[model samples]
Every structure is written in C-alpha cells, then in structure tokens.
Target: MCLLAFQLQKHPKYKLIMMANRDEAYNRPTTPADFWSDYPDILAGRDLEQMGTWLGINKQGKIAALTNHRDFSLPETGGQSRGHIVSSYLQSNETPEDFLEQLHNSKNEYSGFNVLVGSSEELYYYSNIEQKTEHLKNGTHGLSNAFMNTPWPKTEAVKKLLCDYAESTNEIDVDVLFNMMQRAERFPSEQLPDTGVGGELESMLSSIFIASKEYGTRCTTVLLVDSEDQVYFEERTFKNGVFATAQKFSFTIENPTA
Candidate 1:
C-alpha cells in the first residue's frame, strides 16, 4: 500500500476503518483481491512478479499492510521482496509482537518499508527505517511512503478526512470511504516533500490519488471491521488511471478478539 489512513478502535460502531491505495508501475502484473488457492484463508491482491501482497487479511481476523520507504540516496542493495512481509504476517501463528521482533532481526534483509500487522481489536505499526514496533493506540492514523503519520501533505489531509467522517457518521459506508481515497488533487509544489526524488516526480506523487502515465495508483481498498466482527472489504482496480473493475467481499470474522 502506498498511502493509507485508518482509525483503530475509535468509531462507535466500527472496530477498525481503513482506506488505502496501492501505487505501482503500469506494466506490473497484478491480480485483484481474492482468496488465494495456495493460501485459502488469505484475501488480498497479489503482485504477480513476486507472488506477494501489499495488504491482506485472513479468516482469523489477522490484518496486514505494507508501504515501501522512498530513498534514492541509498545504495542498491538487493533485498527480500517487501510485499512478502505482509503475506508472511497474515500466515503466521505468532502474535504481532513476536513477528515484529523476528522481523527486526532480519530488517537488513529487506529494503526500507513500513508495516501494520494484527487484528482490528489490536494492531502494531513498524518501519524498518525506525526499527521499532508501536502498539497502535485507539485513534486515527495515516501512513505513506515515508514513516507513519509523517504529516506529508496528503497523509494529514486523508487522516483528517477519516476523522471527520467517523465523527459525523454512525455506521460504516464503504462507498464513502472509497470516494475519500479517490481524491487526486495535487498539493502545491512548495508543500511537496523532497524525498530525494526530483521535483517533477515529487509533485506528481503529492496527490492522494496519483495519476501519471507510466506509474500511478493501481487500486484502492477500503476495509471496515465493525464491532460485531463483520468484515467489509472492497477493492477498485484501475487501468491507465481509469476504473476498470471492482471486487467486494464480506465475512464475519471467526472468534474475533483483541
């Protein structure tokens, strides 16, 4: 996931509400969100190149999402595919704390990346850039290519939008969340962060919904886990920056707990 905003245990009717967009090259082959035949319980869009996923969830209510950290100055170090980290966490029997501990030891094996792993009731956030895991508090949070909640223009904007929507609404609306993630307006050039990528590229990526020729948002996913443990997951795939298809799934998590 390239950009995401989520509220954890904050809303009245929902346990967790999240909206995310996955950005990638136009030619990268990908499969829309679905239950993998190999990993029956896992549901997520697959990056065909590496057979890994940026975000995913399982029947046991395990949730995981990842974003790569942008740094051009770093030397070329071929590391493990970061997407596998999400898939690995979802498939693991270990708790978030334990899994993160193990990941910290092998952090250098992967390129810089940020990840959120756990269930709706309790979640943990970690970034290889920081090398620490945070027991996410019950509140709104946002993350993007940088670190978690770094207040990059788009991150703060999306975070506030979620906070307002959750405060005004009593029930979760998948469509509303999707619309929020669809904003493509670019922030002013002066407001864009200099992540080592040149000015032109940085300006293009300033938008919450990136739309460029060769690379842009491939899909948008909105996931809601209500207090009753009902999971609503919807993904809209795009073709050349245009909506192509959408897939929706609903399930009641088995034995949901903190």
Candidate 2:
C-alpha cells in the first residue's frame, strides 16, 4: 500500500476505517481479495512473487498494512519483504506494542517500511528508517512512504476529507471515502517531498491522474471495522491498464459462545 488514510475511534457502530492504494509493477502476480484456502481467516491480495501482501486482515480481528520507503537512492541492502513483516505480526500472539518493539529491534531484517498493526485494544506504527515504534497518539493520522503525517499530497487530501466526514458525526460510509480517493490529486512539483529520488517520484505520483499516461491508481482498497468487530473490505482494480473492476466483502464476527 503506497497511500493510506484511516480513522480510529471508540464509537459504538464503527471503530476503524481505512482507505489505501497499492502501487506496484503491473506484471507482478497477485490474487485479488479472497479467503485464503491455506489460511481461511486471512483475506487479502496475495503477492505470488513475494508471498506477502500490502494490506490484509485476519478473522481474529488483526489488521495490518505496509508501504515501502520512498528513498530510492538508498543502497540496496537486500532484506526481507516488508509485507511479510506485517503478516508475521498479524499471525503472532503478541500485542501491538510488543510486536512493534520486536520490529524496532529487528529493523535490519528488512528494507525500509511503514507498518500499521492493530487489534481491538492497541494500534502501533513502526518505521525502520526512524528506528522508532510506538502506539499511535489518538486523533486523525495519515502515512505514506515518506514519513508519518508529512503532508504528502494524497495524505493531506485524505486527512482533510476524513476530518470533514468525522466532524459530521454521520455513520461512516465506505463509498463516500472511495469517491474522495478517486478524486485525490498528486502534489504539485513544489509540494513534492525532497526524497532526492527525482524524476521517478514525479512519474509515480503524477501519472496516477494523467490520462495520457499508462500509470495512475493500480488498486484501491477500503476497509471499515465497526465497533461490533464487523469488517467490510472493498477493492477496485483498473483492468486493461485503465478502468475500475469492482469487488467487495463484508466479514462479520459472531460471538461463538452466544
């Protein structure tokens, strides 16, 4: 996931909402959102090439997402796939804080990454480049590859939208969030982060909205986890190189003892 926006709360009907876009080379093999036969509790797009995923959730109410660091000039330190870092954490028995601590201590195990991991009681963020891992301070927050809440174009736009919607106190709606994402724009040259990555940065961020270009949004995913622990997962793909193919799922948790 390259861009992610989320709202976390203690509300009764909905507790968490997330919208993100996953950017990658088109040729990479992947399976769209579905129940993994091998791991029935897991629902996400699986990267066949890397055996990892950008975003995913488990039946146990564990949610995880990852994005690569934008520093393209950094020396290639061949390391573990960051996506697997998220998956491994979700599959573990540790709490979010514990998991983040472990991740911070093992930063050398992978390339730079921004990871979000949480269950019902805890939310945590970890960046290998910062060498810091801690629970998210309450309130709205957005993160991309650059840094936490650095005002990247997409992050800023989403933050504003989420703030507006949140202020309305309306039942959280995923469609409205999706529309906002579809309308998000790339940052103008002056607004682009000085990653030193140069031109490719422009291409990656700008191409998403340019019709003449072959790039834009690769996949858009929206997830809503209600206070009742019900999770709604929705994904839209641009096929034939351009256009949205819609898909959605709602995973409800039933109190087995009841």
Candidate 3:
C-alpha cells in the first residue's frame, strides 16, 4: 500500500476505519482481495510475483499492512520480498509486539519498509529505517512512504479528511471513504517532500491516487471493523488508470479478543 489513512478507536460506531491505495506498476501480476484457497481464513489481495500480500485481515481478527520506505540513495540490493512481511504476520499467531520484536532481528533481510500489524483492538507501527516499534495510540493517523504522521502534504491532507469524516458522523460510509482516497490532486511544488525522485515524479506521487503510464495506483481498499466485531472489506481495482472491478467481503470475528 502506498498510502493509508485510518481512525482507530476514535469513532463511536466503529473500532477501526481504514482506507488505502496500492500504487504499483501496471504489469505486476495481482489477484483482487479474496479468501485464499490454501488459507481460507486470510482475506487479502495476493501479489502473484512473490506469493505475498500488502494488506490483509484474517478471520482471527489479525490485521496487517505494509509500505515501502522510499530512499533512492541506497542501492537497490535484492532481498526478501517485503510483501511477505504482511503475509507472514497475518499467517502467524504472534501478537503484534512479539512479531515486530522477532522481525527486528531480520529487518535487514528485506528492503526498508514500514509495517502495521495488530487486531482491531490494538495496533502497532514499525519501520526498519527508524528501527522503532510504536504501540499506536487511539486516534486518527496516516502512513505513507515516510514515518507515521510525518506531515507530508498528502499525508496531512488525507489524515484531515479521515478525521473530519469520522468525527462528523456516527455511521461510517464506505463509499465516502473510497472517494476520499481517490483524490488525485497533487500538492503544490513547494509543499512536496524531496524523496530524491525529482520534482516531476514527486509531484505525481503527492496525490493520494496516482496515475501514470507505467506506475500508478492499481487498487484502493476500505476496511471497517465495528464495535460488534463485524468486519467489512472492499477492494476496487483499476486497469491502466481506469476502474476495473470491485470485490467485497463481510464476516464477524469469531474470537476477537483471543
């Protein structure tokens, strides 16, 4: 996932509300969100290339999402697939803290990344670049290629959009959340962050929804977990900058606290 904005335990009707966009190359093989035949409990879009996922939530209430840490200064040495970071956590029974602690040792085996893993009741954020695992507080937060809530123009704007929509209504609207993430408005040049990808590319990626000939947002996902343990997931995919198909799933957590 390239961008994420969420409200955790800050809304009256829902325990967790999240919207994310996954930007990738047009040719990367992928499967839309669904329960794996091999692991039926896991619901997520699969990266066919690595046999991993970027975001997922299993029937046991385990949720995980990952984003790459963009730093062109470092050489692109091949390493373990970062997508496995999300899939591994969702497939394991380890608590967020435990999984992160274990991952800390082998972080370098993979490229720099930021991962969020936890259940609807609790969530944590960790980044290999910063080498810190944070027990996320109950509030609205945003994550992108940088550190959590780093106030990059896109991050801040999306965070505010989520915070406003969440605070103003007791009932959550999935379409509204999806619409918020579809914003393709790039920020002003002066307000963009310098990620070493030049001004042109930086401006293009500044928007929540990215569209380019080669690399752009391929899909958008919305996840909502209510106080009653009802889980709702929806993924809308795009084909070469245009909408393609959408998949939706709903299920109640069997043992949310366990």
What is the per-residue lDDT of model 1 for residues 133-232, given as tens digits with 9 covering 90 to 100?
Answer: 9998889999999988998999999999999999998977788888888899999998888889899999999899988989999999999998889999
| TM-score against native, each model | 0.98, 0.89, 0.98
- The local distance difference test score of model 2 is 0.73
Q: Residue-wise lDDT of candidate 2 within 81-151, one digit each (tens)?
A: 87788668756777777788888888888877889888544568888888887677656778777777877
Deviation of model 2 at 141, angstroms? 1.1
Give the higher-lDDT candidate: 1 or 2.
Answer: 1
Q: How large is the C-alpha RMSD of every model relative to the true structure?
A: 1.0, 3.0, 1.0
Q: Which order, best to worst by lDDT?
A: 3, 1, 2
Candidate 2: list runs displaced more than 4 Å: 10-12, 203-216, 254-258
Model 3 clashing residue pairs (backbone): none
Residue 107 displacement in candidate 3 (angstroms): 0.6
**Residue 119 displacement (Å), model 1:** 0.7
By lDDT, who's the top model here? 3
**Global lDDT of each model?**
0.92, 0.73, 0.92
Runs with alpha carbons beyond 4 Å of true place in candidate 1: none
* Cα shift from native, residue 117, model 1 (Å): 0.4
